[model samples]
Target: MAQEPDPERLRALEARLAEAKGSKAKPAAAGKDFSQAEVAWRMVLELTSGIMIGGSIGYGLDYLFGTRPILLIVFLLFGFAAGIRTVMGTARDMQERQLRAQAIETQAEHSAGTEG
Candidate 1:
């Protein structure tokens, strides 16, 4: 013979399922609040990638020409300098934009106070 589920148990299970479905889960935090050190770390990673890529290309050229060490060293140093400059420039630009925003906000507040 077949058996039926108890109505009370079925109701309780339904309630639990409904509650679970209705609850909202928080979104995971992305790495948006990176500190200066962390930003530098990321910059270093980019620099390292650039160095590796440039070195690889240089290695290929050197192998074709039978020259060693010269091309790899030059390209890696160039890549490192370029990466540091790019990162520093970005940090500066971010600071400038923030300053401009603050200035605009201050101006607005001053104007509003004068008017009212």
Candidate 2:
């Protein structure tokens, strides 16, 4: 048979659980600190995937038409172009988001200052 639980320990556990629940309401201050390496990897993958997809399509077309090199080269170039375009877009988007975030933070500070 199992021993009875200790009442004092059970109350302590309950209090700890309550404290944890209360702490969950506060927003994390460091949550915005995303890793630069992670963003770099994401950009690299996007560029490579675009290139790979273009190459694959070109290869398929070349095989179908029995024009081995021409279609493949054309498609590879197109894919590289597409990847460049995507990377440019990603950079622009990241810049816009960063600007927006800064604007919001600035506005919040302004409001807080006025209210105080």
Candidate 3:
């Protein structure tokens, strides 16, 4: 069982939401905000999960087919591929973020030069 929503509270919430939507708030985070520390953390998670999933799949395949090492080897390779994919994607995202910041800085400098 759930509690019923209050009409007044709902209206107040709606009004607050409308005001928030109308306000111009700066984005708190962008792709560029991912630091080396953050990337490293994410990489760890990615590699761990990739290895776990790959190992599980390989182990399962091996068990099912009565193959000794083929599945494990193949799955480890798959996990490596996944890690590379994550690294590439993260690098690309960081590059894009850097470009965005550079573009913004360039625009600011141009405007300042023109004005002064």
Could you give candidate 2's per-residue lDDT for residues 2-114 as a string of tens digits? 99999999878877877988742334463564567877887899899989999999999999999998999999999999998999998897788789789978998898899
lDDT of 1 by residue, 1-116 (tens): 89988999987877787788985333254224447787678777877877777788778878888889888788778777777777788788668766866996799789889999
TM-score top scorer: 2
Show where candidate 2 strays beyond 4 Å.
1-33
Candidate 2 has its poorest 10 consecutive residues by lDDT at 23-32
The regions of model 3 sitting more than 4 angstroms off are 1-32
| Candidate 1, poorest ten consecutive residues by summed lDDT | 24-33
Query: Candidate 1: which stretches are off by over 4 Å?
Result: 1-42
What is the TM-score (0 to 1) of candidate 2? 0.69
Candidate topping lDDT: 2
Query: TM-score for each prediction?
Result: 0.55, 0.69, 0.67
Q: What is candidate 1's local distance difference test score?
A: 0.75
When sorted by lDDT, best at the front, the candidate numbers are: 2, 3, 1
lDDT score for residue 66 of model 3:
94
Quote the lDDT for 101 in model 1: 67
